[model samples]
Target: MVFVQYTVLGIFFLMELCALAAFSYWGFHLNRGWFIKILLGIGAPLLVAIFWGTFIAPKASIPVSIPVRIILQLIIFALAIAALYFSSKSMLAVVFLVVVVVEMIIMYSMGW
Candidate 1:
């Protein structure tokens, strides 16, 4: 059981990475010029990373109430999923959402 709990935590981390990748992929494939693509490809993930580090990470510099934290996290995750979908990777977006929902359920139900 302990192993499974830790594995779920690991999945959360991987999902975070996937979100960033999805955002970058969307930005890179935007139907714009190369300069805009480069800016967005780097900027989108960088902005998300900043937000995560500031308010969502385990040791975030600014802590919020649990409900607020969950809301913020969900918004960020949702935006990433949207990016994937808009990039025409609908299958990946659906799979990512399923994994996120499963991970959230396990983490919450198991009191992680």
Candidate 2:
């Protein structure tokens, strides 16, 4: 039973990480262009969340519903992805990565 809990959170952890990576490393921020910002800010993480949770996270028994969990996950993950998309340099990317890590930590530890 304990293993199941850890496994579920672990799956969420990695999915969160990928969202972080997509935003932080691939297609993060978008201050320069409005349309692109909307594209990455909303699209990338939504698609990734659906794909990752559907295909991979199930191995750990995470929820398949997009509406599950706190609203913050959607906001944070999507924003992180957007930030990653628009980031002009590695520093910004790293900041977004740190944000995701911190958010995950708080969610896991105390729902802090």
Candidate 3:
């Protein structure tokens, strides 16, 4: 059970990494000018970091109830998956979504 907890935590970390990567990928591949690309490449992930720090991190500044937190997590992960799918990586998006669902189920069932 402890091992499962640690594994779920690791999954959370991986999910965060995937979100940042998806945001970066979307920003950098914008069909706009180089300046816009650079701005978005930095700005998008910065915005997500701010949001996560404020509302979703372990030490969130403004923490919500567990249900709300889980909902927020799902929304964020869904966006990341959508980003991947729209960026022409549908298979990867599906895989990421599957992994996220499994992690969420385990976390919830284990009361993490």
Which one wins on TM-score?
1
Estimate, for each residue in 2-112, the C-alpha lDDT of model 2 and write its tens digit: 675676567667757766466534443554476776677666667766655554453524554433445446565656655554565556557655766665665456432
Residue 76 alpha-carbon offset, candidate 2, angstroms = 16
Write down the RMSD of candidate 1 (Cα, Å): 0.9
Point out where model 2 deviates above 4 Å: 1-28, 59-112
Per-residue lDDT of 41 in model 2: 61
Candidate 1 vs candidate 3: the lDDT winner is 1
Off by over 4 Å in 1: none
> What digit string (tens of lDDT, one per residue) describes model 3 on residues 16-49?
9899899888888888999998998888888888
Clashing pairs in 1: none
Index of the highest-lDDT prediction: 1
Task: Enumerate residue pairs that collide in model 3.
Answer: none
Candidate 1: lDDT over CA atoms? 0.91
- Candidate 3: segments with Cα more than 4 A from true spot: none
Q: After superposition, how far is residue 97 of candidate 2 from its true place, in Å?
A: 8.6
